[model samples]
Every structure is written in C-alpha cells, then in structure tokens.
Target: MPQNKAAIATQDAPAAIGPYSQAVRSGDLLFTSGQVGFDPASGALVSGGVEAEARQVLKNLAAVVGAAGLQMTDVVKTTVFLADMNDFAAVNAIYAEAFAGAEVMPARSTVQVARLPRDARVEIEAVARFA
Candidate 1:
C-alpha cells in the first residue's frame, strides 16, 4: 500500500477496510479486491438505490485500475456480486457506461449473494491487463 511494485493503492479510492490491498499486480495482470459503494471521502456507503451503488462500485474499480496506471478499458474481466438478482439490469447498465470507451467490453459475471459487506446492494472486482 506504500507504492510498491506488487500492491496498488491510491487516495482517490477508499481504503480497504480489511487485510488486503486495493489491488495486487501479478505479472501483466492486476487483481483487484471487490469494491463497494462507500465514498472515499466520507468512507460511507452512498445513498440511493442499487443503480447509484453500482456506479460508485465501478468508480471505485476505476480508481484501483488507474492506480495501476490503467483505465477501465484495460479491464479484461470482472466478477460482480449482487445482493439481488433483480438488480442485474440496473447494475449492468451502469457497468456498461464505465467501459463504453473500451474497444471490447471486459468479460463479466454477475451473481446474487446472500449478503455483501456493508450490506451493499452491489459489489464488483476486476482484473486489468497492463497492455
């Protein structure tokens, strides 16, 4: 977290609340920890519904990827965790907005979980390529 070659961190993103770095670089891939809707400034989950939360989640991911000197377009894959399957369409729409500039959209998976940290409606993690 101190600007090492392996661990990636940035003040633009919320600090990890657990024992993990925001993202870790392994060779040409950077594996990111799941990000929630918590605001980096207040460290509190954003208000509004799943749509808002999903947007914040993607924003957080962008921050992590940016810290790795990459952009959302560089994300090769993502695993989305949702508290409700019904929110898929909503989250997906927001997700698409973030990667609109990508020549090819990142591969993604969305699954409904029993619960999420901070009781967030949605959470997302990503893998980014250096190239």
Candidate 2:
C-alpha cells in the first residue's frame, strides 16, 4: 500500500543538505527534519554561540511548521541536539522564549552529540499535530 504522506518545503527555511525533505506530513502529524542555524538565503551557519544558533534553529523549525499549516502551539514533541552540553542552559533559555504563549508546550529531549553538520552548535527538530 502507498503511504499517506507528503513532503513539505519552504524557501523560508534552509534547504536540506542531504536526502531528506524539510518536513513530511502524514495524517494529522507533521515531522520536521533537524534544523540548524544556517541562514536560508546564504546557507551559512549564523555567527554566534549556542544561544544565537538556538534562536535561529527555532525560527527554521517554525518556518517548516507554518509551511504545514500548523502553529508552534501545534508542536507536540521536539528533539534537540547540542554539540556541547554546557550550552544547555543558553539553548534552553532561547527555547523557552520561542514557544512562549503556546497553549501547551511540547515535550522535548535534549542531548549532547559529538558534533553536528557544518559544526553547528545546536540543531532542533519537531513533530507537530494539525487540527
């Protein structure tokens, strides 16, 4: 049987560097690929520490969510990957502000990884539900 899925893309967000769509929608759920701090137009990692990277990451994820016709409040879960665990606090602070005012905050898992694509300090991916 064929899958009930559709690839989601938007120029507002960075293009995938590998074989993957920016996001995929199946049924009422939208799954976004990991987003780093890369600026969509220039394809360069934003210059700053984890805090700045985290902010851009959220913005990229939000762009994908919006492309799927969903809002940040619709995000049900997120997985955050950090190059350094020490930056957790900084990333967390920015993350909190990004999802502020949402009806319900999404569940999240954060972990430090050995490294990330393009040496990004942080990367984030999300799962959102559509009404």
Best by TM-score: 2
> What TM-score against the true fold does each predicted structure earn?
0.95, 0.98
**Per-residue accuracy of model 1 over 9-127 as CA lDDT, tens digit each:** 99888999989999999889999999999999999999999988988988999999999999999999999999999999888889889999999999988899999998999999999
Instruction: Note the residue pairs that clash in candidate 2.
Output: none
In model 2, which runs have C-alpha deviations exceeding 4 angstroms? none
Screening candidate 1 with a backbone cut-off below 3 angstroms (N, C-alpha, C), the clashing residue pairs are none
lDDT of 2 at 90: 92
lDDT of 2 by residue, 26-90 (tens): 99899999999999999999997777788899999999999999989999999999999999999
| Candidate 2: residue 42 lDDT (0-100) | 98
What are the RMSD figures for all models against the true structure? Answer: 2.9, 0.7
Q: What is the lDDT of residue 107 in candidate 1?
A: 92
